[model samples]
Target: MGNTPSRKGYEKQPEKTTLFKKEPTGITYRIPALLYLKDTQTYLAFAEKRSSPSDSDAKILVMRRGSLQNGSIQWSPSQEVTSAFLPEHRTMNPCPVFEKNTKTLFLFFICILSNTPEHRQIITGRNKARLCYVTSSDDGQTWSQAKDLTESVIGKNVRRWATFAVGPGHGIQLESGRLIIPAYAYYVPFKCFSFPIPFTVQPHALSIHSDDFGQTWRMGKMLQRKSCECEMAEIIDHEGRSHLYCNARNTHGHRVEALSESSGAYFDKPRLAPKLVESRHGCQGSVIGFPAPEFVPNDEADSIGGTTSPLSPDTQTWLLFSHPTNKTSRRDMGVYLNRSPLHSSGWDQPWVIHSGPSGYSDLAHSEDVEHFACLMECGKESELEQIAFVSFNLSDVMQTVDKREKKEL
Candidate 1:
């Protein structure tokens, strides 16, 4: 499908409902904030109750479920645990992670500017724009106070912002328990933030590591790519060797998704996928990683595959799922798929997996997307399900169909 005209071509299904939607009670249902969910059994879902989205005042509002489709898995009403920040400073971008060595949960988040400058402080010395984190316990049910980790994890001189500030990238907690994070600097003309002198695009990424859990993080190898806010996954080939996949922004203003060799090393430049999910639009989301029984066709070795990927004849391939859009307000979003023979074919088919509204999702290995988190709906937890909990897991395909059927029911 390399020649597929646009990403929107591959059609599978559409989201009947969002990961979480606004209920009539004025509270917004939340997809789990971040990387906390892994297995099917356990995950924390969250949302905020704000008079408005720009209010910056949000509660740590939390929820948990038992299963993906067991029953009603809606979250608790949004709470105003506004935390210790000032009136303008509130919790934002709350993602969950775990350090296997301690069995402790890591909460990584960015403090969006609300009121004063240096107001939303975390690391105690520098007010970082791109990165910061928090720790958690009991499956993200509660959290440690905010700590501005950007300066500790990313260099402060890397990027710049105007009047207000902007932050760098965020990451996921890998199966190896390595905190894989991405960061970049940029200027938002809307924020009306001024520039230094002659206009220049912000140099994007520098990968970081946290050997001592989230306490003391240091910069590792630099990912000189022009992409920012990368979400990563370790894709093991049929040979069991691991590689990394990241979706990023290139200089061309197109939201391009790329691949890499090592767990988080050299990434191939972003190629023009079939559909362009407007990462530039305010509606951009992350790439949730997945592998399936049918991910790679068995005879993929004979497939018209590219040379960048390993030559794999394996049937099981790895999938990159993203909601690409041609334009921001364009509701005709496609859940596009790019396949690579896990054995070595490189990413093939910039094909379609599902389509509908562009929202958020983390790859949950199962028969259905919604079923992955049903554990939360049932109010129970399982230790065996592999789920990557993102800010929002896309609404389930089956649930969407069932809802359509119920309309007739």
Candidate 2:
């Protein structure tokens, strides 16, 4: 498919982009551009609600598809469907999932603490966060009113910042027709909120099984771990075991994805895998069933948590998507794509799908990456994710730092 003609590459170079536009970076950037699929075609997109390195209040844009066999897409008008209704000081995580059983689309997100300069310098104690939800019946053309899922079950002593804690990054319906939702939670950062005693924070990947589709739910086991680590997505194994994955970042800057086996009921603590992504704090990535090619250089690690991704019916391979940041002050970040063989023992390959104005990336799938017939969000993030232009510049800073690291090393 890449056989198209290359115009006189030796004779010319591409135009230089404006510096102000900046490159993708880990710092000042936050994007979990979600991915979703419609027809056989794929589409990629992100929200304008977040305060990523890009601009504030950006629009949600879809990819342009191919005209021939790969038809292109026109940009849809941006929607203000993020956490704009929440207090301006709060940030959130936006995750989308497609439940095949009910044919329903669920958008799960959580509003969290502000890392703004003022908050960081002046505030003390654990910061409180709230979790919310919204739904789209028509492939995201429009969303149902945003609803608060936190008040329903969650009270206090909980940090919504934990991956999937607000809701599952992705969920699976069991053979018994029970809906299994992936979820996580942890103690707020020691001084994150206003409290006298720091809570015993335990990050985890747990689930909520629903017999009536999301109308009612039951709690699953707490994926046991002494450290904070939880952001779970599902993949049905060849042996019929369900594997739950997420990042476990200890005091070290590096992060490893841990896996747990669940049989619709019980779960084991995450067993560590060699998948090493230099997640400074931690990054969310996603996995689907695309059988991506491979990562030649860094060696694709495991564990990804992004907006939304799914496994193909055959489940031979999985497409994993994410936004990349460096171990240093992340900036000049970009979107990356990767793949892993199902039931195999090796980390999958990775590809760079797209780059952001800043570097907060969430990945989803619809049809294509180059030309989106369907992508949820990768271009930018919603304020629900974080709306700080102040920190947005961190992506630029990360670029400078990474260059220096390579030079020194």
Candidate 3:
């Protein structure tokens, strides 16, 4: 698989549906996080509606509902989920995690004081950010007032962070009822080489989790240094023990991945996942795990033995990953599958989604329809101009089918 050329070999091409377009609605729209509510059987698409493409200009968080009706996604008009009209402050990073037991949704994000830009924060080593969230019982039809959680959940840790952000994508809830919001914080280092820069800084992925169904949240130990912009997945291994899998953005050529044995309270040292390389500075990617497909025999191995071989440890479940296939440009969004959750080499060659301009994406599965959906940033001219949603069946990915199925609102 390593020898497979990047962006050269792809078979399947699914239909692309535009969910949110920039302008007349908002001057600019980006950073999408898609959530599928099982109870409501609805798709919630969240994005930052900004005055411009500037990071600090997104004053409002917008959402839209898409009902799963008769095998098609029928989208509703977009509405403002939350906004901060106060000067120099804006909401960013829309990350939502559903609590199955309570049928509640928690939307987590960061409020940044624009007076201090990210570059200044990186240099000064002080984060002018607050963690906040809103809840909904009616599957995004209505939402509770936004609540600030920085003081209680992060507390003094903010003092050490230069800048921090929660998932620009979706978070996950484990089978054990542990809810986690994947996040990253930039920390300024004490040592500096006074030459090209006055100080050094690094980012690492961490988790803020809730055990009591969003009543309270707690910080988890940070993953190894230099990881950022992560997404989390709950994976049950062959041993029957549940593990938290983290796939994070990295600037060091490849994606950073780690596993947590303690339901995301802590993670082992992170390692580079070579199969999932990052584009340029890095791009946020999406990951999801589904039930493993029935095992098929390898003809070469079967010829050697008459006895049937048991499935490998990696076959306990399957993981689906989405990201840009190119190492340099955020184009050609691809979906990768891996039967082994722990081994980096197990990822199959990607099945390309958008062969043109594409950026950050979030993945969700529909149990009723037995298909997966990808909400991503894509454009005809530039990658960040519009947010689109695409759906595909598991067979399309596994078989690499070259087909497109269109469904319009």
lDDT string, candidate 2, 69-173, tens digits: 343333343344543335553444445555556666666665544443312221333334555666766666566766666655554434333322433234445
lDDT tens digits, residue span 7-46, model 1: 4432343222223444355444332343334443454544
Q: What is the lDDT of residue 242 in candidate 3?
A: 89
Clashing pairs in 3: none
Give the distance in Å from residue 56's predicted Cα in candidate 1 to where it truly belongs: 5.8
Q: For residues 141-195, write the lDDT of model 3, one tens digit per residue.
A: 7888778888999898777788899998998888888899999998655634432
Sort the predicted structures by TM-score, highest score first: 3, 1, 2
Candidate 3: segments with Cα more than 4 A from true spot? 1-10, 24-26, 83-88, 191-199, 295-315, 401-409
lDDT values of the candidates? 0.41, 0.40, 0.81
Q: Against the true structure, whose TM-score is highest?
A: 3
Reference-based TM-score of each model: 0.62, 0.58, 0.89
- RMSD to native for every prediction? 10.3, 10.9, 6.4
